[model samples]
Target: MERKTKLALAKTATLLAAIPALVYANASGPDPGLTGVPNEAGTCAACHGSGTSSINTKGGSVTVALPNGNSYVPGQAQHLVVTVADPTAKRWGFQLTARVAAGTSTQAGGFKSTDSNTQGICSNSQLRTAQPNTSGTCAASVPLMYVEHTTSGTRLGTTGSVTYGFDWTPPSTDAGKITLYVAANAANGNNQDDTGDHVYTATYSLTAATAAAQPTISAVVNGATFAAGIEAGSWVTIQGKNLTTAASCDAGSPRPGCRTWSSSDFTNGTPTSLDNVSVSIGGKAAFVYYISPTQINVQAPDINAGDVAVTVTNGNGTSNSVTVTAADFAPGFFQTGRYAIATHQDGSLVAPASVIPGASPAARGETVILWGTGFGPVSPSVVAGQTSSQAIGSALAYASAPPNITIGGVTATTVGAALNPSALGLYQIAVTVPNGAQSGDQPIIANSAGKTSPANVLFSVR
Candidate 1:
């Protein structure tokens, strides 16, 4: 009985010793550096194929689905999936690596496991399980990083196909182009050996996304009327695409809490550029007031009347030159649709009460202040980019010639017309509502130096 028991124990130990060789053969993922990338040991076929069958000969395919189609943005994380499919296979496994396209042996980006189905390996001479360092990179000594399936990820007894998902973060800066190498195995699930398994390999190429576009100029027009003309010392609006790298707000403009140009943006005078965005009219730098991606407000430089070239320059590059008509006087009123912008003596807006939260129509024989732009030069010579000086006299920089003012086709007495003391390239005209003016919306017009304001402008009267 003792001899028989000893013989049974011996047989049991022998069987247990052989179990590991069969179950652990290539399980828990293969060794690193076997992705079939350049400088690596071929592919899974190096071990799975019995040296008789060619790779992918068993009618199976391996594929990788990239996150951003075929392009990758620098420093962006892309989720990737590798799939292995076969009609007869009941088990699957895969390994993948990313490398610079220019140097296939040089690692590109870093990988992280997004699920229990996958794990990361860092390889130099041998492979060791690793997580991306705090800087999202592998140690320099173990420069190569690989992602592959875990033991449970094999999905034994599964049919059709199996997939593994992971996340890869591209290099911090533009790496130009990158390539991903992948190898997969579709096993018949016999588990006896790797004899009946089929190996498949694939590669995917990715390119860096295109750079930001340069500035483009579409039109140059008067800031007030949006008409196609500019005058010396007048506010001009430039329409374009990519006019500035960022949106900028004027110090006292309506938009609040936005980035504005600091004193450093000026060059010994009024700022001609805001956040590296500048405009040029006839080769002279215009004072930049507001900047955005699609529009820019600037005070046109004192250029002679004729055709002038306009361009916008930003961090990306300079825009194409646009030709626009320039004149000494291109008069236009600041209006809301057809209504001329005006303020009552108490500073309330002169419009139908419904037009604004606090507005009332003008009464006949009442005085109102009108605002406009591009009304030609002012006396005592204020620079295009400089604010009008109050010391120039209490009148505050009167126009070279008083404009012809009419309300409802009856000539109204112009009390005063001058450049606004606090604003650049802005004009203020105070007039008395004519007693003969008809009630309701009345067409108001102003002409200076033979240039007429838009005739559609109206003023509300009661």
Candidate 2:
């Protein structure tokens, strides 16, 4: 079964089982019971082997597995098993055609075949009972059924009792239906009939257990993960924890109980921190030890990337951790794109400026492209005049000028200006060369900067 982490698609898992079986299934369902064979598969091999869907019950319960190779081959050596317990039956043993076909029932709960003439036998216990006693010569796969057989190495079960157990590679999905239809004789020898008043089928239930509950995550967290990281006026949803916001949890230290968030499980989102965390009925509250959010999606902080424990508030007390990362972030900035972005001294970064081809010192009413690292991301104010001495004669430095910008009051300043030219971070600004200023092929004074642009690259005003 797939565990649900709200939006999570994958999960981490761990579980163990004792019986492994290979059941034969034809279009008609479980094939007829096989009996009296000297092999690791016991008597079940006659039906489970070769071209049949019936799996041998000799090796305990054999798991019908699907491997990396989609197709199964002939004579392939495999580990498998099967198990049955009748507390009141004469004794315990692996499933045999005798048992399956006989529709044998325990006196009360025992599997002892009154026919085996054996008495006081125990039920199957995984990995404990290693050996099973049989009255015939069989295949190598046959002996494996009595894994607890004293000869195998360790007898994990009671004396004279047989159980199913073997190493298994397991399967991708443990949530499907498997059927057992082979028959066993109640009296053991030469019985082809499934004769017994109690002859019937049993259903094995499937479960998604404890081992598959833990979550796997990957993400970036910082104070930013907790809300605007002190920049916003207030409030931010610290996202993480396939997480929730309200629940019986703790916060770190003096602020113990209910609010501690770990740096390792946090992330930033549209509004930073989340609100209206569900305290009940499908709330956004997540694990506090992980400081995950039920209100928002969070990723597991990488141990290699220097993730720290900011505040782990679980049902227990709050705690802090200094280190958690196993390594660090994978190499490269502008990781997938064409730009070669690097850190600069001003703390401001940008993409290559958008350069305007022409239009400076125009006669009147004309557009000029003002190119530079920081250009009009949105509509911006502009000023034009004769080139001032500060200008480089041939160029104008397009800048953020006077007032800073804001997006409908949302402050869209998360990104900084990258002054790389190859990336062209500049833009275009236009204005008249200014009615009566100095002419003579002089550089135009782009905006209010008193900078002198180059003379040769100058435009003429009528």
Clash count, one per candidate: 0, 128
**Runs in model 1 lying further than 4 Å from the true structure:** 1-207, 247-267, 390-395
Off by over 4 Å in 2: 1-91, 95-163, 166-177, 180-214, 223-462
TM-score of 2: 0.22
Please estimate how well model 2 matches the true structure, expressed as its whole-model Cα lDDT. Answer: 0.25
The residue-level lDDT of candidate 2 at 462 comes to 29
For the record, the alpha-carbon RMSD of candidate 1 to the native fold, in angstroms, is: 18.1
Best by lDDT: 1
- Number of the top-ranking candidate, with TM-score as the measure: 1
The sequence of per-residue lDDT tens digits that candidate 2 reaches over residues 51-145 is 22332222223222233222212222223333332222222223322121122211111122222222111223121222333322222333222
Cα lDDT of all candidates, in order? Answer: 0.83, 0.25
Task: Give the per-residue Cα lDDT of candidate 2 at 205.
Answer: 20
lDDT of 1 at 308: 96
